[model samples]
Target: MSKRKGEISREKILSSAEYLFAANGYHGTTVSQIVREAGLTQAAFYLYFKSKEEILDEIFLNFERQLDQFVETGQQLNQHNFSEVEKHLTQTYIGLFQLFGANKNVIKIVFNEGGQGEKLRRRIVNQIHTNMTQNQSLGILKPEINTEVFAELLVASIERIAIRYGIDEDYSPAYLGHSLAGILFQGVLTKNT
Candidate 1:
């Protein structure tokens, strides 16, 4: 089905805002610039978004919704799947990498903008920690491990790798995911060393 005019206009505004926010810092970008880039009038922009900050909030909301969907669908790590843990982890990471890759612009904005990035990072870390704690209860993760620290480490590592490889398209999502899974599960040290 075709999108309604309002829907199209709103999407244009969002797309333009995301691009501008990524290219120029969020503080540097203006409502007028976003409207101009979107090929819509200020009135149209306002119809969709109340203010520049509101647009950014909408963008973040969109990203968060997508992330939530990914988490819900990609979370399959459990005690029942212990034998296939590596495979499940690799697939989960691949999905995450792809999600990040697709939203690279939003990721750039999130990391480079301000305290909002920190807020988003903290929320993500918390989600990961919650998941880790659940897995620990299930005996999938070692009880000795600190879920909070591991969650923070995983988020930081994934964010860095996504920016480095996923954004640039330097490596496939599968490659990055597989590599990350290997690194996390097996460690960087060689067995013989």
Candidate 2:
């Protein structure tokens, strides 16, 4: 019961922090604000997190873990051809959009407000570039393409596209997915056709 209570308290703190940070920006929010928002004492917040920066790291890492899962899943997908690749890529984009929507507040806080988000983005882009490098070596991605540049551009493009959809909920994920796939297909599809 205590364990469960602790878990609840921790999630509450994170939720409050997400809301507060999203609304006020990380720099604008304070520990007192988070504790008050969570309705928990500062001691409880301390028990779960060392500081506000720690909370940000936790939030960022949670998102990173989700991205890692997607990257692992992506490795098993679309190993054969461009059409299959486009299908898999589109589906992945849709999933990403859904994930972004679900964690909209945190996403807004991390991406829009300056802090650990930039570091996290760079780390994620690096991971993507490394994964692309592996794929190129395995001939799953075109060897002629520069994986570093490709990964950076791809991440930037997706982030830009996501921001557009994130602001307005009316955009269909499928349409965005197809549009993303179209752009990627034009850029990275090998000459196997």
Candidate closest to the true structure, highest lDDT: 1
- The digit string of per-residue lDDT tens for model 1 on 10-117 reads 999999999999999899999999989999999999897878888888888888888775454324576446788778777888998998888889989987877778
Stretches > 4 Å off in candidate 1:
72-75
The positional error of residue 9 in candidate 2, measured at the CA in angstroms, is: 2.2
Worst 10 residues of 1 by lDDT: 71-80
Instruction: Provide the TM-score for each candidate, comma-separated.
Output: 0.93, 0.83
In the range 1-193, model 2's lDDT, one tens digit per residue, is 2568889999999999999988998889999999999999999999999899988888888887887765554466446475576677778887777777788887887787665778878887888888788777777777799989998897888788778774467687677777787777775666795
- Note the clash tally of each candidate: 0, 0
Sliding window of 10 residues with minimal summed lDDT for model 2: 71-80
Q: Cα miss at 48, model 2 (Å)?
A: 2.4
Enumerate residue pairs that collide in model 1. none
